[model samples]
Target: MKVSAEIAGFMKRLGHEFAQPELLVRALTHSSVVSPTRPDNQRLEFLGDRVLGLVMAEALFAADAKASEGQLAPRFNALVRGETCAAVARQIDLGQVLKLGRSEMMSGGRRKEAVLADAMEAVLAAVYLDAGYAKAQAVVLKLWGARLDGVAEDARDAKTALQEWAQANGMPPPVYDETDRSGPDHAPIFHVTVRLADGRSAEARGQGARRSIEQAAAQSLLAQLEALA
Candidate 1:
């Protein structure tokens, strides 16, 4: 385990004191660290994923008392998904906290979306375990509320684009599938399948719901149109 005053500052911004800073550090430590007792983030990644989701779900439910679980569930999944977390992690310089061997560091571990997403999840887990749900919720809200809202706005644009593309080509609008998801609550991976009217399929991933499905749809449409040409 490693600790530094510098890393403490990073945690400070996230608004929690680690009950086990080692876990927090391990969450940031890549597989490439020193050999003797090096620990990677995979295990913490597992815990963080669940913690992240619960917090997001709680936030959604509390914010909108009138929204039924059926209505709120998908939105909850979207906000805490992996791609969104990775994007949020990027925004907060989470990569800088990561500990990698010189080789991994130079090769751009900092820029790998999956790694960043995992670290974010681990940190969120640590937050939940350390400070409990309420404080963890606050940290996440400050970090992600505007971003989730933006994701919703992007959803509207995606469907509009799909519609326009369909009408222009005289083709039927696409269909979307919720294939799979991974990661903890704060960050998950949503796999979407988009099918054309003719039964062709295209798959895509997004940090959140509507965009992920739209990506699937857009990819399918593009592939179908390309084949026709």
Candidate 2:
């Protein structure tokens, strides 16, 4: 299938013009689209996840000579997480070109973090399939610019760090509560509170999964604690 002018412009923004334009088409197709002839991006997303992980792992390994596996592991997780993938997808405006079913479109699937992240991975796989691993690596490195540089510094999980601090100070473990859940079912917003035994607490709002929201709330509390210290 031929790509539309919009997809052509998107390819320009993505920094890679496809030799086989059909790959790009497949990447943008969501499962909800209901195409008998055309396939969704699920398989491509799986491949892209592995490819992205390898690229990030190699990049981290080369960048940090003395970092232990412990240090590099968290950095790798940060780079390959759904939030990071969604950020990259936003950079390329991938949502604008996504092919969703009527229900999904009406529900704002394009703005969902999980959808964007999955599409981003599929696009990476498309690039890899269209050209080669080298080209895909180049694109990933370029798209993920600056994030790679700062990832090492921000690699530590906020919740984990906060827990360690609490344990070291002989305090009980931090508790997380979902204070509020709002918005439509398709795109819910979670208000999570992270409270410590010492009564210092912070709340944060996050969209998407409850786990991510809780993590965000923990991060907010950790930042507050650090600032007070």
Candidate 3:
């Protein structure tokens, strides 16, 4: 199937020209728009997740010469998580090209984190099918870019790291409290504060879930402590 000018432009941003353009079209087709003749991207998303995992694993292994499995695993998770994938999708404007049903489009489906993440993976799968593993790996690396260099810092579980820091410094565990919450029930934004036994504290706000907000708060606190040190 022939792709439109917009999709061709997306391909250029994605850094791979598809020999079978239909794969890319299918990759961008959401389940909300699926029909008997029009396949969706769920299957492609599944395959792409594995492909992404493999590429990340190999890259991390090569990047760090002395890191243990425990060290590498969390970095892998950070790199392959939905948040990171969605971030990559946004970088390439993948959401703008997503084909959604009217209902989904009305609901702002293109901007939904899960939808963008899934479509990013599906697009990877399409590239893999159109060419080969090497080509797909190249695309992933190119898109991921500087993220690979910073994965070590990004991989740390901020809450856990903060707690560990408190312990190492002979302070009690840091405390996290929700300062405020707002927005609709379906999408609440949480404001959280993390305070140490020594009275040092930091605050941060985030959307999606409470745990993520806590993590953000902890990360903020960590940054503050690092600056003081």
lDDT of each: 0.73, 0.91, 0.91
**TM-score, candidate number 2:** 0.91
- Residue pairs in candidate 2 whose N, alpha carbon or C atoms collide under 3 angstroms: none
Full ranking by TM-score? 2, 3, 1
Alpha-carbon TM-score of each model against the true structure: 0.65, 0.91, 0.84
Alpha-carbon deviation at 192 in model 3, angstroms:
3.0
Global CA lDDT computed for model 2: 0.91
| Deviation in Å, model 2, residue 204 alpha carbon | 1.4
The prediction achieving the highest TM-score against the true structure is 2
lDDT tens string, model 1, 1-229? 4558868878777767776787677778877884668778777788888877887777776777887766676577668767788888988889888888887777667777777898898888777777787877788888987965554422333445666676686778777777887864434568787765667667777654346556665756676667877
| CA deviation > 4 Å runs, candidate 1 | 34-36, 148-229
lDDT at residue 160 of model 1 (Cα atoms): 51
Q: Write the per-residue lDDT of candidate 3 for residues 127-165, one digit (tens) a residue.
A: 999999999999999999689887874477899899989
